[model samples]
Target chain A: MRSTKPRRWGERLIEGAIKSTGIATIVFVLLIFVFLLKDSLPLFGHAKQTASLLGTRWLPTSEPEQFGLIPLLLGSLYVTLGAMVISVPLGVACAIFIAELAPQWLRELLKPLVELLAAVPSVVFGALGVLLLGPWFAKTLHLPVGQFAALGSLLLAFMAIPTIVSVSEDALHAVPRALRAGSLALGATHWQSITRVVLPTARSGLIAAGLLGLGRAIGETMTVLMVTGNAAVIPQGLKGFILPVRTMTATIAAEMGETAHNSTHYFALFFIGLLLFLITLVVNVVAEVVVHRMGREAK
Target chain B: MSALPSAVGRTLTQTGEDGSQSAGQSVAEEAFLPTCEEVPCAPNILRPEGEIKLEARSLNMYYGSFQALRNVSMAIPERRITALIGPSGCGKSSFLRCFNRMNDMIDGFRLEGDVLLEGNDIYRRDLDLAYLRKRVGMVFQAPNPFPMSIYDNIAYGPRLHGRPDRSELDQIVEQSLRQAALWDEVKDKLRQSALGLSGGQQQRLCIARVLAVQPEVLLMDEPASALDPTATFHIEELMLQLMEHYTIVIVTHNMYQASRVSQYTGFFLMGELVEFGHTEQIFETPRDKRTDDYIRGRFG
Candidate 1:
């Protein structure tokens, strides 16, 4: 009875420590939200400043400093959409190959390599984008400068691929072997079974994986700041992908260092930060809901 | 021991009009029964009933360095249920998978011998795999209904082979569901997800899915081992009814189930075909002492 008391106390101590860590994480996120809102609240105090903030351009340091949200918002959207366009098909195909087609030895070898890609620092990716890819695009596409949105999209897609491949491969691997065997037994070829049974069953997880990649791509700063030729303008349609554009992350990152500490420009940058945070929060929420639904259905 | 005047001979007298037996080709089969040497050869009581649908001639299977099946050879009678019974890991399921070459999916799997289906060697390199699987469908131990609607699940096989007209597909779906005895229960809810069905219904749906392809041979690997008693009974009854159209090869661990549904029974042990005979004789008067011990529940 005395020995049981000590063991129970030890277990209770460990449980309390775990529960406190969970609460501490929530508190830390709430603190960050409060801090962002506190700094951005000054932009809403005056009608003139609010009007200038929503104007057509983001000329923060010039006379009549206009802070149009359109160009920055559109720039981020273009980069994200282009990145998804490049990453989804390639990521999903690579995942399917890793999960279903690769032999055991090759699978073991490739899986760790894919994870190693994710572990690479973002700054290294930025350096590669600036040094190697920038010049290649300029020569190949005959553009005046290689630092365009397409280059940023290509680099971000490279960064997002590892996440997409690993998560979607896990999803495909989670599909039951019995389902594959059943499909094959019914006269369907191997490829037919993979497309018709395994892929469909893992559809929700794949979507969640894609959303996670989008979250990663949209929030990236250094890689895009270096390569996207940060020009604040509303880019045109398909032609705009090859033109210079400035994203939300790059905008705040470029201006925050030079802006006055208590200036309206500083407050506007905080507002952009808040917007970026909200977008990522919404994306992560949707991803969590999808992954949780997939887990339930799997049960 | 002598043959106790085969019961299959008596059933031939009252055979139904649905082409039960090829009129007395039995004289030739009985002649071959006496020359048994190494293995205890019984007169293959089901031989009078139907032609041999599948024959495994000295099949040996290996997985990497492990031998999973020995010199296993048997002839499965057409339009009848043949059950392979053994303890766990005895390779009954492996042997059942040989008919449709399902084991080809496994890595390091090697087979040295011929598995003949209707006199054609299925292991030949030139055979069309999709067509081979179409002729020989399978049902797994666990119910694995596709993650789609019940109607789509049944239509999957036919749609893969050829794009039938919509009306033709509907007819095929209805006919298959009815044949599996699940049409009435799922008729109103054909659009519902197959995963929403009960375990027994899902298994029946899988059976219907296989039946939609109109396969000539059906391989069931412990089809009812995961079901309740009522569900198992339903599956047994379904197998019996299905015997009129499709030949069945089942792998099971249940002695009673083998006796109840199978006309012919093959007992396997350590990847070897220990004994093969009529179900009743295997349970009552097995030729091999190991087979007798297994049936009597002395040890697995």
Candidate 2:
């Protein structure tokens, strides 16, 4: 009885430790948000400068230092959208091939290899983008500067593909086998069954996968910073993909070290950080909700 | 041992004629017949009155090295309810799946001999699987309604074969659901998800889904096994109604269900067709001891 009591005490201590750590993680996240808000709140004291923050130009070092956010916001959007365009189709196709078409031996071989892609350091992808993809783009597209939004997008797409493939593959696999059999038994061809039934059934999860990939692409700083030429200019139309652009993440990373602490520029960088954090949080939350819906529907 | 002398003689003569050309045919005949020396071969009984819609000729099925079905042959009549009853793992469901080639999806599954549909060898290499499945539609044990609108679930099959106009789809969906006796229940909410339907309605919707494809034969693998008693009764009644138009083959574990719905019942044991005869005769006067034992609640 005494021994059991000591074991029970130990178990309670472990449980308490786990519970506190979980609460602590949430508290830390809230604290980070608070810190960001605290630093960025100083910009609101200068109403005119704060209003200029929403202007089209982002010439932070020019006379009076215009801090327009449109160029950077649009730049991030262009690169993220470009990455999604390249990765979503490729990742979904790869996932379908892995989940449905690949034989046991091939699936086992490919699944781990795809997951191994995730382990490759982001800095390595950045280095590769700078050294290889940029020069190749310059040569092929007849561009004077190879570093552009497309170059960063291509690199970010490669980074996001692993997450997209793995998550989407799991979603596809989660579709009940009975649904496939029902489709097959109803005279649908194998390809028809996959496209008509399985894909639709896993639709929400697929969306979640795409959103996760988007989040990864949007937040990627190193690769885009290295490849996008760090040009804080508003890119023009569909042609913007080939033009050098700057993402919000890249701007914050490049300027935070140079800006004087407690200055308006520094506060603007913190505000951009908060924007990035909020955008990613929203993307992740939406993805989580979609995944939960998928789970319910699967049941 | 030989109370039915006339039946035994007739069976032997029939087997002789059927087995004259093929060595494999004779082997299959011998395997089932020789073991029941005390009783007449059950297949020689008063045959059902319709033309054969599906037939398995000396069918042997194997999954890798493990045999799931031995040499088994049976004939299913057109527009009739034929029930295959056996205990778990007795190859009854496997036999049902063979009609529609549903077992083809399983890895390492190998089949010898032939399954014929309307006198055409369904197992032929060049046979269009989609067409075969269209002609021989199946309902699984659990009600599997696609997670879409009830109307879309019924329309799915018609749309797959061809691009039907929206009006044409609406017509097909209505006709199919009506035929399955489900239209009235869901007529008001055609756009509602099929997953919203009750267990019984979902099953009937599955039936309607198959019927939408306009199949000649319906293979049901314990269609009501997952439903409540009331739902099972509804399914049974629906099966009876469907028998007027579709040749139905049902695999079931419930003995009473087989006796109630099927005109012809085939009893399977350890992957062999132990006895196949009129449902009345099999339940009342089974030719083989195994069939008699199973009917009387003995070891399955």
Candidate 3:
């Protein structure tokens, strides 16, 4: 009993430390949510001014300033949709190749290299977009300026690929080897088996991967800001892709420093931040649900 | 049982030259014809009336530098249950996977010699894998029904080969479930997820899924090993019933199961066939010392 006393004390100390750490994390998250809410609430008091802020234009510096988030929201939507279009198919296919088709040595070599892609800073991606892609798109596509939503999308898609590939590959790898053998033994060809059995089995994980990529792409500010030619205009249909656009994160990052503290513009920026947070929260929750369901189905 | 033998005979005959010649047969050399040769201590397990459905001649299997099966040879009689009994890791499972070329999925799985199904070498370059596997279905040690409804699970194989009429698929699903003795338990819930079934029912569902393809041979690797005693008894009875319609090759660790379900039994040890004979004779009067020792619980 005496010897067990010291062991019990040690265990209590460890348990207390872990419990405090968990509480600290939750407190920090709640604190941030409160701070965002407090900053964003002042806009509601100036109803007339805030109401106009929901209109089409977003000239924050102009006298009788407009703070309509439609253009910014549209800009974010366009870039994110475009990024998913480019990345989802490419990422899922690359994942399948790495997980199923690649030779043993090649798969080993590629996994670390692909993970290395995630370690490259977002700023570095911005630099590459500015130096290489911007000039090429401007000249080749005959645009007035190279920086546009399309350029932002291309860079953002590149940034999202590592997340999608790694996550989806892990999902594919989780499928039981027995399922593949059973499919093949049923007289299905390799391609048939992969499509019919393996892909469907990994569907939830694949969806979660795409959602995670979307969250990453939407939350990314530096890459889109540097490349998207920050012209705060509601872009026209189809032609808008090649034209300059400014995303919500870019607006917050570019203007938050310049805006007067606690002013309507400042409050609106926090509101945008809140919106961004909510979008990310929803996407993350969905991803978690999908991944959780996938774990359950695996049984 | 009476109707089963003729149905299985027709299907097994369908795997022969006349049965498959009409389908795409990527023409190859008319050479390398090999027959089942006599091996010492082989107890003439081939019943007089049963036909040879599959034959493995001088088969040597290797995974890189490691040899898994060495010069193993055997004949699988049509419409009968042949049990491969051995202790763990004795190559019984490896030999069973050879029938449908399921080992081809493994990297560095190299094989020398031939595995003939209905007198055609399965390893021939010109053979279509889809066609070959369709005729030879497999049930794993663990139940592996797809993450779909019970109806869809059975329909997966039939749908893969070609799109059948919806009504025809419905009939096939029902027939397969009945064959596996799972129709009554699952008929009302055919649309429900197959994952909801009990472990025993899931294994039977897997068997039904394989049967949906109308396979001529069924390769079972410890089909009842994962089940409880009652489930094991049910599966044993199911296998006996299935034997009338399919050439069943089962790998089991249960000596009693081998005796109960199989007419022919092959005793394996250290990747070699020590004896192949009728189940009763092998159990009652094993010719080889190793066979006798194993049956008498002397050693694995």
Candidate 4:
């Protein structure tokens, strides 16, 4: 009798599918990079366009309009950093409370509620900021009562909290039970055990959580648009800061519809979009690195 | 030679806070207090050897609705090997853990009775259990070394409770290892991961680790159960040497091991003690019929 060999048809299909996915991911990333470069070709390489960022006040409708993105760049950083200042500590505390201290029933109820914050639409958060936070800060601080960077930061912080809490709670839970038991047996109190054992063990995971929140905060658009004064100028003070400071995302969203075809105003918004995509990409890489380091340390 | 079993019974009662004494009874093992009245003691059970280190009086242990020990009373003398031997589920290991209040770590564990350690009511509310455990250490049946190096394993107990001086710690670690008969074998590889040690070596390291805490009464719950024959003999030899300086209460499933290592032996059956006496008398001339049957291999 002849021996029958295996065909592995199913295995080949799986392999092909995996390879296709890998190729698709790379191609998708390449397409974004190439498109951004193609859109910004004028500023970097278009000699005939006669780009003069210094003199022009960015009236893209004029024959020779400027597309200086320095204001948008400054705006993006200001809002992202401001949001981070508010959210990092608040999010971390919320995660710790949910993971370690809250009672079972309370944590069960509270965790899902906090998670719902993440599920809420960015547009809704923007509307809430415009209706609530923007004016509230404006009145309380006695500044120009308009949408501002402060409002954008407030909305962004609220939005970022859920991602940070969910990821960090999981990180804290990932700490080994034995380590906790060992610390307790050694006569360490529960607080000490959490601080010395659990927190240290979960440090990397928490850092990853922060990085993920940062990525989301930096990429957010609508909330910043609706509440932020949407002024393209850099903020002057805390009160004026609550007025919307135009972000890279907002620049693209607000200007794209009215931007003249083949104009520097249009290309500048594309440049800002490209910058955001890179910022998010870098944030993802950092988050991955922190999480990998945590896995390595856990062993 | 003095027997000082630390942290037994009443000394650890302070841990009863947060409704743990009654509510925590689930983790409280019932196999500890067998109805000791059924067991006949050696005519000399009351013939106090030298200094009495540990004593259990009218101890009753239960697991929820199930009673594990009934009015169990026993005494362990100083610097002597007292072995509690019985078949599976006989409450030997439970009794061993009682000496160190280790059962407190188990959830729902509660003990109803007095355990005296050197004339002190160990179960009293004011007693500090963490400090008491320092004086009465334990070795578990399975070798459970902390995930650390061999040196750290031995040094952990001393380093805790304010022994921070490096040289003093080194001296304590070495002395304890020598007491456990493991200094020579592990001296060169002190920094290696304890999890990398051979089974017997790890057992000895655990012994050394417990000894470093400077416990006077050593509670071993089948220390050799997981070791090879050679390791078993070495542990037996160590026990003999240790008996000269410490009161030892060992729980073993192996009968011959009980006979060979311990001077005093007790047999437990179904939450009740069947016999306890001199090793020779219990094995050769048992007062109770159950003892005879057990020794004769009659379906223990």
The lDDT for every candidate, in the order shown, is 0.86, 0.88, 0.86, 0.75
- Candidate 2's residue-wise lDDT over A38-129, tens digit each? 99989888887799998998988887888899999999999999999999999999999999999999999998998898888888998898
In model 4 chain A, the worst 10-residue window by lDDT is: A48-57
Error of 4 at B91 (Å): 5.0
Per-model TM values vs. the true structure: 0.92, 0.92, 0.91, 0.70
Chain A TM-score values for every predicted structure, listed in order: 0.96, 0.96, 0.96, 0.88
What local lDDT score does residue A271 receive in model 4, on the 0 to 100 scale? 68
Q: What is the lDDT of residue B255 in candidate 4?
A: 89
What tens-digit string does per-residue lDDT give for candidate 3 at B159-256?
99999999999999999999999999999999999999999999999999999999999999999989999989989999999988999999999999
RMSD over all Cα atoms, model 1: 5.6
DockQ each candidate and list the results. 0.78, 0.83, 0.69, 0.14
Instruction: List the lowest-lDDT window of 10 residues for candidate 3 chain B.
Output: B24-33
Candidate 1 at B112: error in angstroms?
Answer: 1.5
* TM-scores of chain B alone in all candidate structures, in the order given: 0.86, 0.87, 0.85, 0.83
Rank list by DockQ = 2, 1, 3, 4
lDDT of 3 by residue, A1-299 (tens): 24544456788899899999999999998898889999998988888668866788888888888888899999999999999999999999999999988989999998898889888999999999999989987888789998999889988998899999999998999999888888888988878888999999999999999999999999999999999999889988988899899999999999999999999999989999988989998999999999999999998
lDDT of 3 at A146: 83
Q: Which stretches of model 1 miss by more than 4 angstroms?
A: A1-7, B1-49
Candidate 4 lDDT by residue in tens digits, B146-181: 656888877767666674688988898889889888
CAPRI-style grade of the A/B interface in model 4:
incorrect
TM-score, cand. 3: 0.91
Which pairs clash in model 3?
none
